[model samples]
Target: MNTYKQIEAEILAASNILITAHKSADGDSVGSSLGLLHFIEKLGKKATICHPDKAPDFLDFLDLSHIITMDQEPEKVNTAFQEADLIFCLDYNSTDRVGKDMTPLLESASCTKIMIDHHLDPQDFASITVSDTSASSTAELIVELIELSENGSLLDEKIGTPLYVGILTDTGSFRFNSVKPRTHEVLAILLAGGVKHYMIHEMLNDTNTASRLRLQGFAMSEKMEILDVNSVAIISLTKGELEKYQYKKGDTDSLANLALSIKGMKVAIVLSERDGIIKISFRSKGKVNPVNALAANHFDGGGHANAAGGMCELSMDETLDKMKALVPEYFPVQ
Candidate 1:
């Protein structure tokens, strides 16, 4: 049986399904979780979506009021996990990716666990895993899964919207190397299903707040530092700086991408100071593998080769020092 057939058979045999995505929920995470919930509901199954963190305002276009959040309602989250007969973990690989609070709850849940992700070196935690590291996003995988099912008609506007958001955000609006011909094929099918592609793009990118624009200007003028010899650009922001601008969850969404747009820049780094850790985002062009060298080796993080994230428990300057120390090793003066 194919992935959809196999998953659908399991779904048919079970009810009370709970779906989850990782913490600091990105577009792909929100899209896949909501999209899957809609699909399951269309199949006449009891489905609930749970996310470990709050989603950004940019994704408010999608109706996520029903999506349970651990931050907002712990009891609801716990109840959903407890009553769930089958849990589909979307977007993320490891259970811990859901965050510290949800890890044990998810790991201890006595249900058939399913993982559908497109990340590298996924842990063997789920009973069934539909992982494809090469796939653009889990939302793309979701499209394939729905097409493989007997009820391909469920890929309508409601479902296609979130799926399109996932593909658009995760693939950097079709500019990333991860995007393939199959990705566009799926996008075409979504468009044919009446997904408002241009509108979705406008919401995701053009709907920025005035404060967000001011914050971006500050990031470019005050925080950005170009390492000319190494072909790198670094933008470091402290908690105070973030608060000064009233930083929202997705305020710094594409700052790294902006930094990388400079001429001769091969790598872009965003160092953001949080409560107890420095959140790091790495963006690279060409062959430099941030997932292996920057994220995995230097910091306890990983993602795609071209775009990865990491964190450090040190002062902002200290974190920059550490990152600078590793720069020569990875980028070397070229």
Candidate 2:
């Protein structure tokens, strides 16, 4: 746990700043970036948010529409990297999670690097690292940082919206096990800052497209699997299936919640194919920590005890077999 005074000193010292998050940016990644962007600009410094890919449509409601995307020419993004005095990596701890494409920029950047994340593994790239897995979301941490800064009085609606979004998504709308009293305190402050509750809720939950809805239905009907007498549930979607359904990014965001609907399920796993690799997101209902099971079996990922993630290079069939083999080890019959 790094001190806020040190982080404040770093922020004040920086002039031109580049803020970025991991690829396939989700709510926490996008939300944290936007929230920090407002804070950086309020300090009278130039800030730009960059992502390895375009954010999902649902998150487009945020002001990241102009951030450089990964597909842009490297020279274009590197130009910003070259001019930046500091780089703020948010939400993800490791640079690999940010994307292999940005490896050169991350390694070559002459700017001071700061990592503010909630992930389990902390990389050594940052000059200053502020990671707290106990925090509900990186957005929550950003709010705390701003409150500690001289701009504490400047947390307006522009900044409050994204922070609230991060808190909402990371906590599963305050329904997950990570929800804490401090989380509520943060929410109360954001609400007081004029964050529109209904608008943010609609942006996240009510703005689904037809293609996304159809994709969800197809996944529920065809791809869901129950294992070990309903103790575990798995949902999977391959690249071809995603293409056939015209799936857009973020379509599967809520698919893990389907497992929570089951009466006796203890663990739920969602596997998706992206970039020729299998991505696994794990959710648990009780004492199980699927992230440990993932790390033990050659998957490089982890997160909270109740919610975590990992990735594997195996084909879908092989990945399924691996998951099936691992389940019995973690959840034995009493």
Candidate 3:
């Protein structure tokens, strides 16, 4: 049986389905999970989305009432996992991506697990793993999954909206190199089917709060450091600074990309102190200058070459110094 068809079959057979995304949920995670949920619904089965945490406020425009979060409703999340006969893990490469809170339960769940992701080095966990690193986002793969299924006609505006948002944000509004001709093709199909592309873009980017803007502004003007010797830009924010700006989730999400916009910068990293750890986000362009090694080797984190994340046990200032010291090794001046 074809894999996508088998996936469809599983959806049809399952009595209760639960969909999950990685912790620190991003656009692709949220968008892909919801898109798959709606697809499952079209098959006459209702699915629950259990995210590890709440999505950033900008994406709150989407109807998320059906989704249960580990952070907000632990027992209900546990119940959803217990009830599900089949599980779909979206937009993450590994089980640990669900974070410490939900990892043990996910690993222990007796149900059949299917993983759909677009990341490097996917773990050998899920019974059905669809990991396509070449795809722009997991949402792209979700569209492909729907198209490959016999139920291709079931896709409608409800499904396309979040999937389109997934593709939009994961590709940095179609700016990243991970995007391919098929991405635009899938998007074309969605757009033809009445997905309002403009609205998704506006809701994701245009809904920033005042605190979010101030936080970003302060990070750029005050905290940003440019290392011309290696074409690296760094922004380090203490928790106090974050609190002062009334920081919320997703507030610092764009800082690395903004830092990388500088003409001379080849790598951009944003580090913020939270929960006694320095959380880092890395963003870069051009395959010649990948940032994943800096994340994986030095900071105990890894993702795509261009976009990755990590955590440091050191103080914010110490982490910043360590990053600066490590820059030349990856993005050498020569």
Error of 2 at 128 (Å): 1.4
Candidate 1, residue 319: CA error in Å? 0.4
lDDT of 3 by residue, 1-334 (tens): 9889999999999999999999888889999988898988888897999999999878888787767899999999999998989999999878999999999989999889999998888999999999889999999999999988999988889998999988998888898899888889999989876799888878887888888999999999999989888888899999999999999888999999899999988889999998789999999989888988888899988889999999999887788778888888888876
Structure candidate 2, residue pairs in collision = none
Please give each candidate's TM-score.
0.97, 0.94, 0.98
What's the lDDT for all of these models?
0.88, 0.83, 0.90
By TM-score, the candidates rank as: 3, 1, 2
Candidate 2 per-residue lDDT over residues 293-323, each given as its tens digit: 5653557777777787788999999999988
Model 1, 202: alpha-carbon shift in Å?
A: 1.7
Candidate 1, residues 1-334, lDDT tens digits: the string is 8667899898888879989999888999999988888888888888988899789888888987968899999999999999999999999898889999899899999889999999888999999999998899999999888877988887899989999999999988898889899999999989988899989978887888888999999999988988888888999999999999999888998898898888888899999987578999888888753534678787888888888888899889999999888887888886
Worst 10 residues of 1 by lDDT: 287-296
Error (Å) of candidate 1 at residue 305 is 0.6
The lDDT leader among the candidates is 3
Query: Candidate 2 — what's its lDDT?
Result: 0.83
